[model samples]
Target: ETRHLTPQERVARGKAARADVPRSSHAEFVPPPKRTDPVEIIERQSATRVPELVPIRYSRMSEAPFRFYRGAASIMAADLAETPRSGFRVQCCGDAHMLNFRLLASPERRLMFDLNDFDETLPGPWEWDVKRLSASLVIAGRANGFDDAERARIVSSTVRSYREAMIRFAGTGNLDVWYAKIDADLLESLLASRLHGTKRGQKNLTRAMAKARTRDSLQAFDKLTETVDGRPRIAADPPLLVPAGDLLPDVERSALERQFRGLVERYGRTLASDRRTLLADYRLADVARKVVGVGSVGTRCWIFLLLGRDDQDPLFLQAKEADVSVLAAHVGTSRYPNQGERVVSGQRLMQATSDIFLGWERVEGIDGKQRDFYVRQLRDWKGIAMPERMRPRDMQAFGQLCGVTLARAHARSGDRIAIAAYLGGGDSFDRALTTFAEAYADQNERDHQALIDAVRAGRLPAEELPAA
Candidate 1:
C-alpha cells in the first residue's frame, strides 16, 4: 500500500513535480509526427456502436468546431496523452468540455451545478480535464466571434478560478470539502455581480431555474409518452426515439416486458437497500431506444418507463451503454471490470451528490452480446447552458463557474493540498493553460475541417437532421 504523506511532504512533492515538469511546458501542443488520423478514431468507435446512428454522430459533430469538439473526446484524449502531466491522477470526467457542466437536482430536490456526463469518467492525470475544459472555452469563444485577446482573458480567468478554488479546498477540513457543493443559492451569489446584475440577466437566470424545476419524471412522461389502448407507452420519433415495440416488430410485447423487468430487478440490486425497495414500487410500463448527446450518439441507450399508483405516477430511467473510457488506453483500465461500475463509482467519487437511482448492470442484447450499462433517472431538474447564446462576459463568468466546479470535483478524489501547492499564488499555470487552449483550439478547427471534408468526399456517411 502507498503510505500517506504528511501535509508538508505533500507540498514538497508538488513543488518537486513543478521542477520535473515546468508549469510552462503545458503551453505547448505540437501534434506528434505520427499522430493518428482523427477521423480513423471516430470510425473505430463507430464500428462498435449501432451502425445506423453513427452517421447522426458525424452529422452532429460536423455542425461546428465547438460541436465537433464535444463529440471528439477520444481524439482529444489521444492528444492529451501526449501532453505534460503533473504526475497526479484523479477520477476525471475524461470529457470535461464546457457543456458537460450543468445544473442538476440533488436528492433533496435542491438545484445544484455539477459535472453531469460520466460516460468517459476514469482515473487519469488532473491536467487532462483542466486542459480539455480550457480548450473548450477557447473553441466556444471563437464560435461566438470573440477576438484573440478576449478569448485569452476568458481562459486565464477560468484557470485562475480553478487554481484559487483548489487553494481554498486545500485549507478546508476534509468533511467540509466532502460536503461542499454549489447549490442554487450559492450559484446565484457567485454570479450575482456579473451574470445577475441587470434586470434582464436576473430574469433570464430566474426563468431558467424555474424551468429546470419543472423538468422532472412527470414532465418527461407527459412529453415523451402517449396512451395506447388505455395504457401509457413511449412515443416514437424515429432515428432519435423509437419505441421498443416498433424497433422490434417481430418480438412479442409480453416477452419484451419480461426481459426488461428482469433487467430492472437485476439493476436494482446494485442500488442501496432503501433505493432498491423504492424501485420495487414501480412496474415497467414501456421501453424505448433513444439517441442522446453528441458523443453519446450511436451508443446503445434505452429509456424504461415505469408507472406507480396508475399511469400518473411515472418514473423514467435511462440505461446507457458504458464502454471503456477513452483515457483507458493511455492511463489504465478501471479496476472495476464492468465499465458501468467504473462510471457509477467515478461519479459517486467526483460529485458531492449523485442520482439516487444511479446503478449499473450487464445486459445481453438481442444480438446475444453482453454490454455494461449505467442506469439513472431519465429527467430530473436538469438544465444545460448553451454556449452559442453566451456573450463574451457571460462566457467568462460561466467559465469561472466551471473552473471552480472542476476543482471541487478534483479535490474530492485527488490531493487538494498538493494540487494547490503546485498552482501556488501566481498566474503562471493559468497563463500557460490559456496559451495551450488557443493552440489546441487551432488544432481542433483543423480536425473539424477534416471531418467535414471526409463527409463531403463520402469517406464518412453523415445524416443531417433538422436543427432543433
Candidate 2:
C-alpha cells in the first residue's frame, strides 16, 4: 500500500472500521444455568454456584503433590455426571467431606460420629455425595503438603476401608452394623495399628489424643460464652455471637416472622410429633448474618437463637440459603418438587444421626425476596479432627476410619448389598479412584486460577469471592 494514501482511500478505511463496530460497549455476559428451579431464582447464588469450589480444586497445582489433585474434584463430578441412582432421593449434605463428620450428641444423649454440615444440602445422586467426600480426602492430603506418593497411599487406604466395611456390613446382621462405631478405645486400637513398632509413631498417637481431648464441650463452652451474672448470653464477638445482621425494617421483619410462624407447622412433618411440639413452643430470639466455609462465602446464612423459656435453655438454629443441586445440572432432573423439601428430605435420608429440630420454610423478603431455607441446630458438639493434625501412620488409620464411616452412611441410604457385590474381589476401583483423584486435582488448580482471574477482573461479586 502507498505510504501517502489518497483522501478517498483514507475515507474508505474509516467507513469500514465504523461499519464493523456495534453501537454500545456495554453487554451482558450470562452464565449457563447451574440450577433452574423457577422458585429458587431469588435465593443467594453462593448457596449453589460454587465457582470457588472449582478453583479450590485447581489452586494446589503449584506444588508437586497437589498437581495431580487439580481437577480430581471436577473429574469426580464428571464421572458422577450421569448414572442411575436410588429412586429414594432425599436432601443430602451435597459435600460430605470426611472432615464434616464429627462427634455429636444423639437424642439418647449418647455421643456419636455423625454428619454436622448441611450448607449445600440438596436432593440428588447418592454416589455424587460419596464421590465428593472421597475426593476431599485426596485434596486434604495435598493441602497438608503430602507428596504424591503419600497422598496416593492415603487415598488407597481410605477407599479400601470403605469397600471392606461395606462387605462386612452386607454379610453381618443389621443390628451389628448399626452398633458399629469408633469410640476412644477404637481410636486407641487404630493408633496401635498405625504405630506398629515405631516409637516415633507412638509419640504421634499420644499427641493426637491430647489434641482431641482439648476439643470437647467444655472447650467449646469457654469459647462460646462468658459467664454474665451467672447467666449465659451470646458473647459479643461481631457477627459470631450476634445472630442477626442489622435491624430489619418492620415490614420485612414482620413478613419474616409470619413465614417463620408457619415454618413450625410445616417442620412438624419432617420429624416425629413430640419433637415438633417441643420446637413449636420455642421463640425466636434474634437473627443475624453468618459466614460459613471456604466455599460458601456469599450465601445468605443466618443464625437464630431460640429460647423456650429463658436464655440458659438456648437452642441455636441456622437457616442457610437453599438452592438446587449442582449434580442436577448434569443429571437433568430435580430430585424433589420443592427445594426446601429436597434439602430436609435428603438430610433425613443421609444422616444416620440427625438434629431433632431440622426443618424448612419459605419467607417473603423485600428487595425482590422470596427465598426458601432449611433450618437446623447451629452447633451440637460439632468438632472435626483435622487430617494434618495426624502423623503419617495415624493419618492412614484415620483415613480408613473415615472410609468405614462413609460406607456405613451410604449403605443406610443406598443399596449396600448391590454395591458390595459390584466391588467384589478386587481393589481396581480403589486404584482407579486414586489415579482419578491425582489427575483431576491438577484440573481443579487450573479451574481455580480461572476463578482468581475472574475475581481480579471484577467479573464476580466481592462477597462471592474467597481468599485464595
Candidate 3:
C-alpha cells in the first residue's frame, strides 16, 4: 500500500514512529502488577503434552540459564505484552532466539540460513522479536564467560546490522527483496571476508557446510533406523525416541497405522496437486515419538519412515503438534481455522524457501480430543551452529548474521522503508536494545534460580543434566 510513497516519505514515517514510541522507551522492562507466574504459565503449557514427557521438558529447561530462556518463550511473550512498542506489526517468529536459526536445504537442494522454528509465530510488534533475540544473545554471552560490556557491544553490533540491512532492503526492488536469501556458499564467503583471513573462522565455515551436505534423509536413516526382520524400522531409544509398537499393544498397532494413513491422506489435501502425487508414491514404514529441542520437548512430535519404491529410497516426515501461538493472547487469535495451518502459513510467508512436504492436518487423539499438527521432512540437510562454543569474535559475526537474516524475514511482510527510517542511520536504537538486553539477561538468571528453588522445595521434578 505504501508502494506509492516516496523514499523520503517512508523515512519520515519511520521517524514519526520513533517519536510515537521513543527508542529509549524500549530499554525499560518492568514486570507489571499482577504479573503471571512463570511456573504457572509453564504448567498451563504442559496441559496437552504427554504426561510422561513433561518431566523431561523440565529437565532440559533446567540445564542452564540459556536453556531455560529457550523454554521460557511463553513467559517472555506474556512480558512482551507489557512492553512499549511501535504500532507496526509483522509476521514474527515469536520465539526468535539465537538458537532457533539454522542452515537447512531448500527444495532445490541448496542450503540456506533462515528462521527454523515457527511454533510460536504470529503477527506482532517487530520489537518483540528483536528484544527476544537480543536478550538471548546477552544470556548466551554471559554463559560463555563474556563480560557485561562485551555482551552489550555484541548486542549493539547485532542491532546495527539489522538497522543497516533494513535500510538497504528498503531501497531495493520489491521482487529483489522477495528473492533475498542467505545461501550457504555466499554466506561462507561473506563471513570469510568479515573475519579478515581468520583461519579458524574459515575452517569452521567449511566444516559446517560439509557437515550440512551429509545430513540428508539418507544419513538420518543410517543413524536413526535399523533392519528388523528384513525391514527398515526406527530404532527405539527409550525416553527420547520410543517406537509406536513399543508404546501401543499389538491390537492397537494396526489401528494406529490405519489412523496414520488416513491422517497422511488428509494432510495431502493441504499440498499442491503435484506434491500430492509425489507423496502418493511413498508408503509408511514406521513411526516413533521423538523428543526434540529444549522448548519443544513435551509437545507431541512423531517421526515417520516412508519408503518409496525400495528400501534405499526413504523419506522421513515429522508431525509436530502445533498449539495456539504464545503471541495469540497478547496480540490476537489467528485467522486460520487450525493452529497447525497458522504455523504453516506464517512459516511460508516469513521464510525465503520451505520444505516441499510441509503441510498440516487435524486428528483425534487416543483421548478422543482433536489436535492440530504440521508435517515436514524430518531431516533435509539440517545443521545448527553451536553458539555456546563459539569464540568472542565468531559470536559477534554470528550475531550480525542472525540480525541481518531476521531483518530480511521482517522486510518480506512489513514496510522496510518505515522500519529503516525508524531505526535511522545512528546508534540510538542499537544502544537502547543493548541496555534492554543486559537488563533482561539479569532477569533471566533470577528466573532460572527460581526454577532451582522450586525443585528444592519439591514443587517441581527436574532431572538435572551435566552442564555443557
lDDT of each: 0.92, 0.56, 0.88
* Cα lDDT for residue 375, candidate 1: 99
lDDT of 1 by residue, 436-458 (tens): 99999999999999999999999
lDDT of 2 by residue, 1-468 (tens): 321455345334433432332211101112225523211221233334333333332232222323323222233344454333333232446666666676665566445555666545555555455555556666677778788888778878887787788778766655666666665556557657766757766665556455554554344445665565875544555432343324354546566656555655575566678987888787765455565554443446666656677665666677776765545655554556666766777666556667787877776655566677787777655556666565556567767777777777666655455456555547755776676556545545544555445546754333323322
**Candidate 2 overall Cα lDDT vs. reference?**
0.56
lDDT of 2 at 192: 73
Candidate 1 scores a C-alpha RMSD against the true structure in Å of 1.1
Best-fitting candidate, measured by TM-score? 1
Question: All candidates' TM-scores?
Answer: 0.98, 0.71, 0.97
Pick the lDDT winner: 1
TM-score of 1: 0.98
Which residue pairs of candidate 1 clash?
Answer: none
